[model samples]
Target: MATLIGREIHLASRPTGWPTPDNFSLVEAPVPAVGPGQVLVRNRFLSVDPYMRGRMNDVKSYVPPFRVGEAMEGGAVGEVVDPGDSALSRGDLVLHQSGWREYAVLDAERTSALPPVPGLSPSVYLGALGMPGLTAYVGLLDIAGMQPGDQVFVSSAAGAVGSLAGQIARLRGASRVIGSAGTAAKVAYVRDLGFDAAFDYHDGPVSQALAQAAPDGIDVYFDNVGGDHLAAAISRLRRNGRAALCGAIAGYNAETPVPGPANLALVITKRLTLRGFIITDHRDRMPDFIKEMSGWLREGNVRFNETYVDGIEHAVDAFLGVFQGTNTGKMIVRLD
Candidate 1:
């Protein structure tokens, strides 16, 4: 087979605050050779997630910062084009962490072979059926210890993890699921996805909105947006309420440091259990998640939405779109 020229989006410069299109650059290079125990794959879809924004900053965090002038990486689903190992055959569908590119040559061990799900889009593996799904599952089930009959609230409820987290709570028998989003459309979308009450956070003070949405008080809070949302959840949490802290997108691009929720003191008064989690640290739940989430998708108990923009060249726009709230659910770049 002829060697392929691959294009990838690279971090041109680290942003001091909010990112712009100038922070990224597209470069062309030859696809690397398939080494021993390695495979060459052509990516079909690339995921643009909110967490990746943190990777762009030069900070000490859970994941290393993206190196300037180097290719940015995230989740991707692709087809193996050249097999150098028996584990992954040619044309096999695989999920890996080499996104922002059109082709990748990596160790076979680094890729997970995915089985096709009937009537489901393969790209869902990057969203609801993949990391985001697992993040929601572990955060709500393990971290928060959500129980049936709980009154649940989720922030950023129209985005990838938040969207699924709210639905998962309802599926697990939460008495009420309330969600907050940036726009009326997103608020409506989350309600359509089974949130018992959904409101536009921009409509008014988060605390007032949340209280109006869940007058009985929230038993569990799935936090995807920090800042005021966290404060709101804290004020409304029932005694001994549990909160699963996930992404803090509200402050991800803040130029100046943002203050913690002013109502943080309520945590002590309400006897709340607030825990933050990195989804990568909880791999033990993948099996259970796959089984349950797959069944949910198949039975139509769970649903996922993805916004697709074609071509690797549009990757930066897709990534920026996450921060802009341009996507209702997962934001993906489909390579042609």
Candidate 2:
């Protein structure tokens, strides 16, 4: 087995809201020889998520905060270049959690062997068929309890999780799918994704825009950008409407407090249910999601998109780009 050197990303400084280059550092380290029940991976793909922004702050969250000078953790997909465990073999593609790095050595128990996909890219295993896909599925179906003819709204509709949520809602018989995006390009991008309608949140009031799209009121809101988008959805939700709070990409880098508006009272008055959830909590449903998403992919019923940056060296910039709304879909880093 060959010894592969690993390069890891470290948290340099904490950002007030959205992150900048000052927030991250890159370090290279020696890769150790694997022992029994261990696998050395030459990572090919890694994920950059908005949720990581919350984790970067030294504050309380559902997940632990990132420690300074330590590796910033994220999901990665790579081939088993050297195998030391019986569960994995050389050249097998696997999904594991490492950081922004060229290679990683992980305990076999912490990794899973990914199934082969014919005529599909391995990088997507970190995207549509990966975390974002499962996040969309569980948040909408399991958490939101979606049903046919339900009107669904997704904030950051052009983003990694939001984009998929809208399509999944459509596939599951949503009467209408409305999305909110940051840019005109992203707005059009969501519409092209086959959403019933999409609006640019930059166009004045987000809630007012949502009201225009779903005049009858929304049955469910798959929230990605929190704050105003959330308040707006609450203002227009049907009685006892359900909301799946995913991420708050809107205020990730802000140094100031994000203020809530007058519409929040609607949550109590309308009896609207707004709940925040992390994808990790729903891992138990992964096998079923994989089975269903795979079928939809093969049948051409559902599609997923990704923005890739080549090489782990570019991972830091690629990761920071997501906060600037530079990516059109899920942002990933490719090592090969």
Candidate 3:
């Protein structure tokens, strides 16, 4: 075979606040050779997620920060082109963590063979069927300890994770599910996803919106947006309410510390249980999540949407779009 070349996006500079186009650079390079026990893959899709925003900084966190000059990595799905002394065969579909690049060479063990799901693209593994889906599953079912007939509220309801969180609550027998989004269209989209109520946060105070949406108060809160939304949820949480604290995208790009919700005192008075979680810590649940979520997708009980931006050259644009709320569901970059 002729020599293969690939392009990857590198973090050119760490941004102080919100990242700009200048923070990333697309560079051409030769695809690395596959060593023994390794495999070469041609990535088909790349995921751009809200959590990645935090990785751009040099601060210490659950995961290491992305190096300034290295290819930024996330979720990706690809096909094996060369299986060098590995069990994987050519053309095998797999999921890995070498995104932001067109090709990857890694130990075979680093790639998980992807089973074909009829009527769904392999890219679904990066969104509704992948990390985001598992995040929702663990956060709602385990962290929040959601029970049947619980009235639920999810912030940033139209986001990749939040969207799934809301739908999962409804499918799991929540008596009522309310959501908050950033736009009128997103609010409507959330409602279409079967949320009992969804409101655009820009319409009025988030507190008032929550009060109106769940007049009887909520039994559970799936927190994707913090700040004001957290405060509002605290006030509206019924006594003994449970909250699964997921991503706080509302402050991911803040230059200064984002203030804590003013109604935190209410947590004590209302006997609320608020627990934050990192999805990676709950990988034990992946098997159960995949089995249940796959059935839901196949039965049409749950649905997912993707906004695609073609080409690796535009991966940065896709990443930036997440903060702009430009995607109704998962935002993906197509490299094929």
lDDT of 1 by residue, 219-320 (tens): 999999889999889999999999999978989999988999888778888898889999999988999999999999999999898999999989998889
lDDT of 2 at 251: 69
Model 3, span 233-252: residue lDDT tens: 99999999999999888899
Badly placed stretches (over 4 Å) of model 1 are: none
Model 3 regions more than 4 Å off: none
Distance from true location, Cα of 269 in model 3, Å: 0.9
Worst 10 residues of 2 by lDDT: 1-10
lDDT, candidate 2, equals 0.85
The TM-score of predicted model 3 comes to 0.98
The per-model lDDT (C-alpha) reads: 0.92, 0.85, 0.92
Q: Choose 1 or 2, whichever is better by lDDT.
A: 1
Error of 3 at 174 (Å): 0.6
> Which residue runs does candidate 2 get wrong by more than 4 Å?
1-4
Q: In model 1, where is the ten-residue run with the lowest total lDDT?
A: 105-114
